[model samples]
Target chain A: MSIITENNDIEDIKIEGEYDGIIELDQWFDPKAENSVLLILNQRIKLDHSAFEALWNSYTIKICADGAANRLFDYYRDSDGKRYHPDVIAGDMDSIREDVLEYYEAIETTTVIKQNTQYSTDFTKSVNVATLLLLGIDLNAVEINEYDGIHKLYQQADKSQLKDIPLLILNGIDGRFDHTIHSMVQFYALRRQDPYFKMCFLTMSDMIILIPSSKKGYWLKLDKVKPLIGNCGLLPLAGPNIITKTKGLKWDVEDWPTSIESGNVSSSNRFVGENCLIACEESIVMSVELKWDKITQHLIDESE
Target chain B: MSIITENNDIEDIKIEGEYDGIIELDQWFDPKAENSVLLILNQRIKLDHSAFEALWNSYTIKICADGAANRLFDYYRDSDGKRYHPDVIAGDMDSIREDVLEYYEAIETTTVIKQNTQYSTDFTKSVNVATLLLLGIDLNAVEINEYDGIHKLYQQADKSQLKDIPLLILNGIDGRFDHTIHSMVQFYALRRQDPYFKMCFLTMSDMIILIPSSKKGYWLKLDKVKPLIGNCGLLPLAGPNIITKTKGLKWDVEDWPTSIESGNVSSSNRFVGENCLIACEESIVMSVELKWDKITQHLIDESE
Candidate 1:
């Protein structure tokens, strides 16, 4: 289910998948529907069966980031239930159980094994897999799937097709602190690679992510942001840098200097109303609060 | 019922309280008894009650930070439960429920209410209580009851009575991202306020906090550490500020310039063997894995 609320010609579109909640639907939030493809990571932080099912049902092309396939299978164990598996289960087989691996293969969930690479974490491998899948490259044709082949995998993969696809990374943050930071690093890294690639991080409570560039007409609108002043932050994760200009917060900034691990940080800031505006020089992650129930209803209403 | 281990020197240490398993203890992780008090935050993170109870029953004094008192009361509904109501409940009372206030008052737990004070968060108020409690001050006195009268309470309290008592801070991290970050910010803020206030943050899975000064010769003996190589990271949170470090992990350095937001970071690093020596010029929050079972046993065994 998709919630596309159009005010002035596609102002905001909220996609309702398996997860339920009222998400922020704004121009700054939407990904280009044309080029990019959705990629699901192996880590599952606060995801249940229903939400996982939504992502499974919505996207036609899915790739599991290593042990994520195992987590998905283990979390939902109804053998006769609506078993929606990913299109490809690829990663190092360290955490992936043998039984789980065979189960997916038996059900035709293509398992791509990349055994010999330790330098790159499972997440990077998953990104490589998504790159290859988006490029429409056949994995069977590749003779060796080694760590060295990963750089080539990205090179041979279609880079142009990566833009504009709504990539929903699951269980990235809110698990291991290191992993969460790694996910944020990937956010900035990917933004540099494909500015049009639509990305949203689905944590247990809310969707936390980065906005690439600050433009004059950029604004964010949402439906009923209750608990409006819980805990929201604008982190300059890109190191000792400052952010200028903003609207819709108790401590809104105007060209104020901020940076991660140092400098002025905007924390314990309150969201004033249903709509907000934030403009930054480089992409910075903005964490917001939303109820999952509202998110589901918004999508249903939009699709209707 | 505290754990008195074979190697432990002290006794009568207790963790008598009802709590979720979200609060954990591992002897192999935290063997040091630096701060005597454990300040619990009200945030709804994964709390390991059993571990906390073990710690509380052993310690002579315990205090709850605002909503944390509510969480304790909620977790330990059974009156006969070993966990006692905290010695004091301190905070702004903006978030603490009215019913919770009445219940704790009936139980005779002292409530130090701080109103019209945005200068500090609730967690800080709780920390102040712990500090006052450690000094052996009776909080009920007229002079001590006032908001800024914390100094009066501390001055009258005996410092020699609880000189080496270590403070274990629970539910600080691992909740919402912003709150967790705010807790860290508090750590920096407090370190500046008083460099001698020894504190340790007990996160859900492991310990992620700072060692005020390396002066006490704080070193992790490897034989005391299990789950040795989990996803660990040591970043200079107050960066633009570089950190000087010594010993342990793959990237061992003395004054390494570490602040890699997008590219390089000390991630997937391991605790190489029997002991790790680390010291920072400024206070640094170090996230380390814990062997819960061992720590729990240590907490219980030490009280024996």
Candidate 2:
């Protein structure tokens, strides 16, 4: 079962043995693809004006997590000196400035979703909005609740047509460590609940993919990303995993017994080739250090 | 099972019912008590000079993880302008600068344990050194191995006498998101294996306590911390936990279910009072955002 979205531009990776599922990690969040729904969960996005501008323009739909709307207002501006606003602003209206809200409200294209509920985080609310919008469910058409809009929205939506929608989240994994860990846990839980949403957390330091457990473990295509990342890691997020096999890692392990219970994990593992396969009994998170310089250069070249 | 040291300064928190265990969060790393092993994990320790001095002077022993030695070398210089040197430096030695290593090495008191092994992280190796040292077993006395010294040291030392040792870690939770999560996971696993090391991860933003799975749950005395923190979170780090009960949170939950598998969690909870009681079926990590301004003010007052 391939989770990859019919993307096979690269040649099929030659594995000695068979695999269960295919996860095209690098290709899914490619900047050029411009397919991901961008969510700014923070004002701490370290991207320069050009990079932020490029990133903002690449995504089809952009959403801000409450106060992040203020960050977007401050971080980037058009050549005409006007601020770039997100398509939708969703949160519990506690942190965002009123002036900023009015600024976006004035724009007819921007929708301000004031969901004042502690049951879900601003991030979750934003994701819900993105999922609904991506599914072509008009906010005006949906019977939305002030709290837990997804519950109401899920009931009315066509569940069968739900395909994997890529989400490029910024500053989602920073701020508090527990918040960062919580973000990971949320992805795991949310992914299980709605398999249609695929998360790719991007920070200045690194990028993370929460690889859910599969009976047939994942074959990762790293061809496009081999040069962009530094040291990578295959970590157990929710539970322990019995790693049966791996390929193309700097220090490849076979039949490796991994347990969060025992503190045994594969961290700081480098990507030595263009392809890799992970055969594990349970879910594990994979991370690769971003060569920000390289990414910035690529973005610069793209603009040229 | 009271995990707190014998030092009980305030009144014993009275719960209406019964409890199985006690975890004193606020008092464990009490600066006045000044009994801890301070470890610099990165240069990102945001403590100002007086604050750093106060923190450094509080701990009995200090250790740095590899490149962090350089961070220490650069971060704190005495009134004499002499660089601050840790008692021990431990890691794979890949990131540490040669000059910084030599500077620490020249100090007759500083011992650099260059374990070329990747089996355990530098942070783990530093913990091993701290544990062995805290247990009064000298590095010279222990039958040490270049690779996996903890295995050899554990064999030589009497494990029964290993009481709970408080560790004050800085820059331990920042930098990469995975490293932050990995650090938390390590504490969970390490604490389970060796219940003696009480972890207090103090970064600029927050402090995290990895509460292990207790048969009776935990009673967190948040008395002293009520004024020093902004918002707190009861996050599921390793796996899911059925949160049966909680007290002292602004929005308390009863018979609440928590699952990393499903993303159900208690985040951004406020400290309503001075004490908290959490009843959970599985392991859970709790965090409180530090009021850095207040802390800095307190440090200034203390210095005065």
Candidate 3:
């Protein structure tokens, strides 16, 4: 069945048939999917239990970034008494509580690596750890005592063995504004260096994903994912000015001049159809509103 | 006593003497200042009592944007049974509760205007209301039944009577990403039309202000304002790629190229001296950390 609609400038495409050579963007967290990794940053905002559980079930690997260990410890303390240990607890160890560190040390499930370098953030350190782990690097062989341990691990990993893995970063946004922006910068940096590293930041309110300029006719299948409540935005947050053409939006634009300055840019545009196509001249930040009740309902359905 | 330090590329400038023709960016809220205005948006986060009180004491006019009236209502419900009425309650009456509308109606102190226009957001509506109110436009003289009532008031407002007022927007950030970005877009739009409308978004964590590209040798006097906790960031959130030079930051850059994309952009950079100088090739978002305890202490001092 198709529900296509056409106006003067806007066209709604209902995604049904399979397309050739389409790169499916991992914007949703499916409980059955195992290709994604979860990286938790420092405790900026409280994680919703249902959302966290859903994410925990979907990801293959989970790593805590420095002080994030304390947050994780507190989260799992009262529930089942069984520690939901992460594969790695990595960062400069500045904000990580001593007791929490000892708890992780006592329970040999988590490897705590202290990267004391001030040049890079703890979140970056965690990303490096995930990169090394994905590349099948032998953790023991890598020097864990050094300040740049993750960097060493990255160097030792076989270049051919590296695979593109999707990462879902939690506590990434809604914190200190600088920290949040740094995370976005890392997203741009990592993707530019390695095109395969697909990442999304999950905040308490929304999910932020980068729609790269390389994908000219990018089709976003909204019906395939969980339902969102309100409107989404195409944010020209970084880089140069971008000219965009969009379909399936309430106020769809053709050859729209969008930049960070005064007159242009689409901020409160809403998706009107099941599928949307976004053609951008440059990469920009696109965020979808997260319906918390719908996510919780999905978890309930999965359990049943 | 000046403490100017230099490394290979980084330089720290100790602000000792005042410079000529410098516009002091209203990045900090002083309880003593009476020329500021506070505009409250829809309730995304709880307003800290101390912070709110401090802001309440500082600003000359207080306006509530649509659903923010509900938040203001709840905030004053249990405390001393005294109502904190706003000068204007403006927005599309979609999200505003019926009880809130009636309560304001019962108490004739607040003017509730129903702007049913979907073209502009509640924030923008509130801004328009503030503009009209500032111009001494008698509400009785203007027709308030129409959808674009405030816009009409603006048209009737004498051009010579318009004043550039500083605004402090509360609950403006850290909510839905689309809403936050829209607020920012409005900031750019408002300022472009009138160079005098200085505005800042005050969240629970940080204060966001735009360092316009027009101001080349912009020197930020950090010591004159309330003390911030830690570092600040120069976010190239909007606009084209920018080349920047700075003094008085922990990692000050000299003629550094910054953009929204990969390798550049200064995020998580810290202020190292009492005053900082930023010479930006283009306008960028600058955020400074908020010291909650210090703000609360100031409130306590005022009370004593």
Query: Which model scores highest in DockQ?
Result: 3
- Residue-wise lDDT of candidate 2 within A106-169, one digit each (tens)? 9888888888777667887888787778777777655667776764675566766666667788
Provide the TM-score for each candidate, comma-separated: 0.80, 0.87, 0.90
Each prediction's Cα lDDT score? 0.57, 0.72, 0.70
In angstroms, the error of model 1 at A240 is: 3.5
- Strongest candidate by TM-score: 3
RMSD of each: 9.5, 5.7, 4.3
Cα lDDT tens digits for candidate 2, B1-304: 1121222333334555677776666443454433468888965556877777766766788999989988888777768978776888888888899989888888988888888786677887888778777777677555667777765676566767666667778887767755776687767767766677787888877888876565555777765556778778887656656776676666667667776666766676666656777877777778888888777666555545
Question: How well is each residue in B1-304 modelled by candidate 1, as lDDT tens digits?
Answer: 2111122222232222331111122332343454456677876635456666667765555677777877776776555653357777777777678887787787755554553356556776676677776555566754554455564454455554443345667777656666666666666676654444555677655567564444222464444344333546665554422345544455555555554344455655655544455555554556665556666666565555
Better candidate by TM-score, 1 or 2: 2
Best by lDDT: 2
Order the candidate numbers by TM-score, best to worst.
3, 2, 1
Per-model TM-score of chain B: 0.75, 0.88, 0.86
The residue ranges of model 3 lying beyond 4 angstroms of the native Cα positions read A1-12, A16-27, A31-34, A78-80, A159-164, A224-229, B1-28, B31-34, B78-80, B155-164, B224-226, B241-243, B300-304
lDDT tens string, model 3, B15-35? 544332243543346623434
Per-residue lDDT for A24-60 in model 1, tens only? 4431123224433445565553554454554455554
Better of 1 and 3 by TM-score: 3
lDDT of 2 at B126: 83
